[model samples]
Target: MPETPPITKPRRRDLTLLGLAVLLAIGLVVVLVVRQGGSDPEASSSPASAMSAPSAAEASATAPIGPLGDLARRQADDPMALGSPTAPVVLIEFADFRCPFCAQFGRDTKPVLIDRYVNKGVLRIEWRDMPIFGPESMSAARAARAAAAQGRFWEFVTAVYDKAPARGRATLTTEALRGFAATAGVPDLARFDVDAASVDFDDAINADLQEAQSLGIPSTPAFSLNGEPVLGAQPTDVFTAMIDNLAAGGPANS
Candidate 1:
């Protein structure tokens, strides 16, 4: 018999089609993975996942009024505060004395707020010490509290911020603090010094710091204007608008 022809293997064209189909399948899988991971790969794996959700800074410039109402500790005798306890709106500030942004707010926006809203009895401002800048920050906070004990809190803070450098500097020394206290007119320097170094003052400062942390305030100069979270040292207009909106019984961001 004639030699039997060997069985023919698949044609190259057929092999090429199979390979193309496999490649197409892989491409589809890659597309699916990318879609699942989101467009920004870095954002998809951001460290915020480890924290308790997005902070006020990460949220809108002015958050809507909601659960943050609890942040208002409206003590009638809170000396480090301004305006009336019965004011229509309350603004809670979580700030660090050593934070330049906080100082900026103190120097620029705070005065406006005080003039337009605070003095008008339309708004109240509660101060919370969030000393995130180490020992000096804590010391400054304590000193301010000590000043508050003598009813000079606002004055002391204003003086300190007035003398604060354009950029952040380590200027809050014991002697410097005493000088600021003097400028604020704290009548009893000896008492102020003693109270500033007391455990009670430390605890008070810690309480404010813990409250800020719990509310997801990661930095200084964070504010809650009538329960609407406003982060950073925003423009004076931004604050006035929010205050005006709240005063009119409108929404926080309106």
Candidate 2:
């Protein structure tokens, strides 16, 4: 396996701002504190527990939206995106393939979002490769883009998350990623391999990383729902309600 570059941790200022951004974007003040350790126990336990809304105390403690600029890059024909470009709501996800919470969201909650909002033309989901987990994470992000070149980005993502182990045991070696490409049914493995290592994909992945850093996002599975920030791997219903509220012309923070 080819060696991937070492990953660097973000600065303390960035982490502080990320915490504030979560408070501003989503109303889950308590969840942010808990997520610092790992996936929340309640969220990791089951889909049902994950989807339930936070208590009144948590909800009322919501922070004001920060300076996380216009997050929606609503470009038509974006390969790493799903749904109409003009959908009422855009859910921009900053995720790492190696993050267990990201895997949880991808495996457990994403399909539901796709079925309910994306299929209904009410939401557009755009993926941003925020690979904070080092070489393996960056390699997987590159591989995913390579898969996107063959029109199987989501398929590749599903395959990876489906096989992802518990947090801290990521299996994103180049060989393993190639196996994922096969599982995702990429027709040309040769082209996939080349594209995964190309300068183009590297630049593309870096762009996403820079964007996340600019917004002070220090974690995976962070989201921007039509410019509203939502941190952590929240449940299906929480996402559904956000979409529904947006569709009904409710406030982004509602």
Candidate 3:
């Protein structure tokens, strides 16, 4: 198997400073995102947990988000990524399988983006696993990677989120994840199970998680498109407008 790119980890002493800052932000994220990931009554239809993506005009008026562009790995063989590596606009998504809003984005807006942009060679999507809900969420992330090892990452994504509940975290236990693997057509079930049960993939997963934490990403389904932070499961038009702006040459990286 190809190696997962390593994210540079901070020195152990630096964690103190990082943790103190992440503590407050994560607390806010847990509270705000609980309304979207757990038993919140209004999670089904609201984008409340998200950070709010700007319209094309707003994006145009803002200063170029040059530094944020570094988040795009654009690794050609990265199994968790989609579309052309050289696409003009690259969208980085940080999400957890157990997050309802992530499910909503997977079920709704993502397909449109895939069809309208990804398929047309204008956009690339790179996924980062942020398993914030708990161990089950973490397990699901691992299981998804197991499928990725067999070249079924996107299929696993669709199976896991395609029929998930719109208002709460999905059931993502080992057994349930195995079922999802089946639905995703992972060619080697035994291998998938073993890999899912192993800790070998945690580094890549944690790297993605830490990157999101370092950025103070408030919740799941958050995105950075051509380096602009867009929090939430935004509307299709919002993403479309942004893509159009980028395609029209809004930023150097876009």
Candidate 4:
């Protein structure tokens, strides 16, 4: 078993944010008890250090709103999003295709979340590409965006994660990605391949990377729930509790 490290707050850089950057930073106090596993593949299955989670009172006292809350795009037709646009909660995830912890969350925890909250119109989930695992992961993100254009983004994402190894990068070569795209039912593989190889998704993917950097996110599988920063792939109960608290009209800092 990989050793759990000491609890550390999210890194706060002495920098200014403007416009879209502000959407990912202001009021998003980095108070997450995340694992180090996602940042280092060798520690892939290491459990989260939830023993360091803040007390309920401490958590409530700092519940943020305002700019933090506005992080939810709620766009009516975002291809990479799940659930109703107006859902009470929005879960924004920053992840890399080659990160094991990210794949674990996708394979294990996310489905439960989808069943419990997303399906009920109580929550929405948006994906952000943080391809920090290098070239193959970048390729996967690009392919994912291309898949999105065919209205198969989520399917493509799930398929890639499902096929990925639990301890290393998935083979995301042009041929492999196209195969995955075909499996995901992307109607036009010819166009999908072209788009993936093009620079069409660079700006959007770079925006997500910059967003994560602005937040000082140091790992994959980082998340924001209606602006509440959650650092790792915690248990399903952890997510449900947060959603339940918000769903019941709990207090928040405006």
Q: Rate the local accuracy (lDDT) of all candidates.
A: 0.82, 0.81, 0.84, 0.78
Model 4, which residues run further than 4 Å from truth?
A: 1-69, 251-254
What TM-score does candidate 3 reach?
0.73
lDDT of 2 by residue, 16-80 (tens): 88999987877675667657536556567678656542331132123222246446666667889
TM match of model 1 to true structure: 0.73
Query: Lowest summed-lDDT stretch of 10 residues in model 3?
Result: 49-58
lDDT of 4 by residue, 1-254 (tens): 99978545432232332454775664353322133434334344444424222232233333334244446666668999998876777789999988888888999989989999899977789999999988888898999999999899999988888898877667788899998899999999999989999888999999999988987889989888767778888877778888877766673222
Once fitted onto the true fold, the runs of candidate 1 whose alpha carbons sit more than 4 angstroms away are: 1-64
- Using Cα atoms with residue i matched to residue i, what is each candidate's TM-score against the true structure? 0.73, 0.72, 0.73, 0.72
Instruction: Point out the worst 10-residue segment of candidate 2 by lDDT.
Output: 56-65
By lDDT, rank the candidates, best first: 3, 1, 2, 4
The C-alpha RMSD in Å for every predicted model, in order, reads 11.9, 20.9, 20.3, 18.9
Error of 4 at 221 (Å): 0.8
Model 1 steric clash pairs: none
**lDDT: the better of candidates 1 and 3:** 3
Largest lDDT belongs to which candidate? 3
